[model samples]
Target: MMNKSSQESRVETISEQLSLFALNLKLEQIPISVCAQAKLHMLDAIGIGIASSHYDFAKNILHALMSLQESNDQHYQVLGVPNKLSMRDAILVNGTYIHGLDFDDTHAAGVIHASSSAMAALLSVGQRHNINGQDGLVAYLVAIEVASRIASAANGGFHEKGFHPTGLVGIFGATVLVGRIMKLTAGELTNALGISLSMASGVMEFLEGGAWTKRMHPGWAASSAVTACAMAKNGFIGPRNTFEGRYGLFNSHIDSSNLASLEKCTNGLGQIWEMQNISLKPYPACHYNHAFVDAAVTLRQENAFEIDDIKSIKARISEKQVPVVCEPQASKRIPKNSYEAQFSIHFVIATSLIKGKFTLNELENDTIFDPQILALCQKIEYEIDPKSAFPEFYSGEIEIQLKSGKSLIHREQMNRGSSANPLAKHEVLEKFYSNVERVMSHTAAKKFTEDFLNLEHEKSFINIMNQLKVN
Candidate 1:
């Protein structure tokens, strides 16, 4: 336990250290491998944004923002849309589109969709400021490093307490990113971070109704951070002890008994790159359900059994994930919409077993109500895994009993696309190709890919945004 004096010092230490770290980061100082991985993560977010643009939610958000538009900033561009928006509106829409499909990259420990806000801020503000590709990439990496550490320090406490860590912690990262690109002084950056404490908020209530709130969390984080930076740059004063203060992020957002060491939030900032640990999604669904989807697919492939031959199916998951994916059993079995289907472990597993794959296609309305998938969903049940490795890797195990008195089991200790069980570089690019093709022709996708992957060499960030815009 820390005494009041030491605690106050520690609080000051956290925000101050983060502000200096963000301002001091250099592209050359970062490892080549980490930079390469960051680009892939950003690429993944961009592709998802473009694909999400074609959806009704994207159109609705764009229309709403357009109605309120006052600024005629021509530099900012929304993904898959031709209209120019103010930097803030573009950041919000771009962030929303990246996270809209719930397919963005997530740091397993932090459980945050980092690149959504990082990329959104970089493209929108980075372009408005005419930040070059190299500097813009560095700023994006800064956001990832800051966001991952802040959220992972909570040790999944935020999610358990019904707060979405992405919106809460991601704002700090975005703040630092914008502040760094804008070249704010250390005090100004600290003030920007302090202002973010008041702005940070996102709840897990969306899970109950499958609302679109979760989709916009990252976008809101990015947009709010930009506001914070603008305010701070103009000499707005904010608390110095924002992280370790008496009424700070962890204290206000989570229970005291559940909090992890605050020191974990800033230790080894540049040396141990948290961005490298971020995992790209193989399925367009809640990451918690991914391992089970894979387990079901593997089990069905290895054993020969008719879908009718299964007597019962069981899933072993981290108890922490139960409320998020397994429970609301009735709703999980028969999801009412794509958002619900994406979060439902029962729907994902059942569909994976019957169809032998779970992909963006599985989230379609017809698949959500598939008679065969629904029939299998009824036989599924869950138990908490005593040895679960959640908050490290989203692990899962599936056990199926056949009417012929045989039981089969498969366990995915590390989900795919994670650091340990990584997808090949080519595999990551393939996912980007598949997603972008949904909104672009093959030729355009090919051209976009060549330029995007070579982002560091580009002199201007506008060149990248121009490729993403559609008239």
Candidate 2:
């Protein structure tokens, strides 16, 4: 058997090899189904970004970012904003907005915010170069595949190591997408991956403070990736064995690195694609809180329990899943920040039960903390379920005991908006309109939606970019 040092070296070497293989593969080589999924994810991400632009912070970030750049050359357009900026800046701002509301698509295997990094980078670069829809779609696929595969292999290892997977692994995906868009050689792609790995960063501390830092992780990934690819294009040479080096990503970040999984990253690369594994979010909260919300909503509907009738509420979750949520001390009111609302199971469950539906408005509205909601929230209690599957895919069961001595129980096995139960195209459109209607006039939103639906056939990037308005 290899000694510990030697084993570490082997893992790095395998990781680097897989990275190079994936970087060089062609679009035609990728399965058609995977390409289609990439388009779906891209559409979903763009819609979310456009919708989130209405948020105060998103608008502030956009204005601040534009002010910092101060160029009218129009390299790329900011989503929902008429102002155009450099490719890198556009990607950073757009990517941040997409994830700002925590509404982006997720892949459960690695708990990755897949499209925020990849699609954002691709849209920026593709628009700048005026690349066709087919090529743009291909680049998006390459990026998602690279990011999600690395995430799956790295699985909770980064989280366990106190790093957010979306920010760290997201760089790799963004690098691959930008590299593909730039048409880097396999060697150049390897260098870009190396540079990106070195730039990878994001901490879980934001989860504790409910800070806005998490919103910028994907944006930073996109920025770093564009910089890495740009460096490679300028003849900058990076460590070729970045993935498998002695102090490489796998060995350094993950405690039990599986070199074997690296092979799966490149296995059947042209035949099987990882992009299809992504799940859409039906709830605005953390993916961990989805099943709980689902179960609570179901219980409320089934029992016809009026909010006034509930004497006590008990939520049972898996042991592994409880630490991130179940904050008994949380204020029984609308959260102070959007991040707070997303992390609080108490707030999410209460709002869901009282309103019969959880909307983005409810999450942000101060009025959601009415005495009735707070009263209901205080009665809710959480217990760990032995059979719950969590930190993998979110699942939970909730049991409620009412004042009249009656009991109601509900169990949610899988996340509702997953591939297993995906939101139809109509539903996605509805979500987009709900968000856009908050900021844009009905006529403007309709025109924008029509143009976006036909984006795959558009010729000039200017036409699409022109549709965006700051107002």
Best by TM-score: 1
lDDT (CA) per prediction = 0.88, 0.74
What lDDT is reached at residue 465 by model 1? 75
Candidate 2 regions exceeding 4 Å error are 1-32, 70-74, 256-264, 327-334, 438-462, 469-471
How does residue 59 of candidate 1 score in lDDT? 95
Instruction: Please identify model 1 stretches exceeding 4 Å from their true place.
Output: 1-12
The estimated TM-scores of all candidates read 0.96, 0.88
TM-score of candidate 2 against the unseen true structure? 0.88
Candidate 1 TM-score versus the reference: 0.96
Per-residue lDDT of 1-471 in model 2, one digit per residue for the tens? Answer: 778666433424433554455555666676666665565567678778877776787888878877887566656777776667777778888888888888888988778897998877877777777777666766777777777777877646677677788898899888877887787766677788887778988887776667888888998899899999899888888876665567777777777643425554555555566666788887777887888788878887777767778888777877655656665345423356668778777778888887778768776656355677767777777887887766456787778888899998888877777766677777776776666665577788678776666555766655665566564
- Clash-forming residue pairs, model 1: none
**What would the per-residue lDDT of candidate 1 be over residues 1-471, giving only the tens digit for each residue?**
878666434435688899888999888899999988888888888889988988888999999989988755645888876877888888999999999999989999889988898888888888888878888888999899999999988988898899998888889999999999889988889999999999997899988878999888889999999999999999998888888888988888888889767988898988999987899998899999889988998998898899999999999999988999988998888888999999888888899999899878888888988899888899999999987888789999999999998999999999998988887888888888888886688888878877877778889887777777786
Q: Which lDDT value does model 2 have at 70?
A: 58
lDDT leader? 1
Clashes of each: 0, 3
- Go through the candidates in order and give the C-alpha RMSD of each one to the true structure: 3.6, 4.9
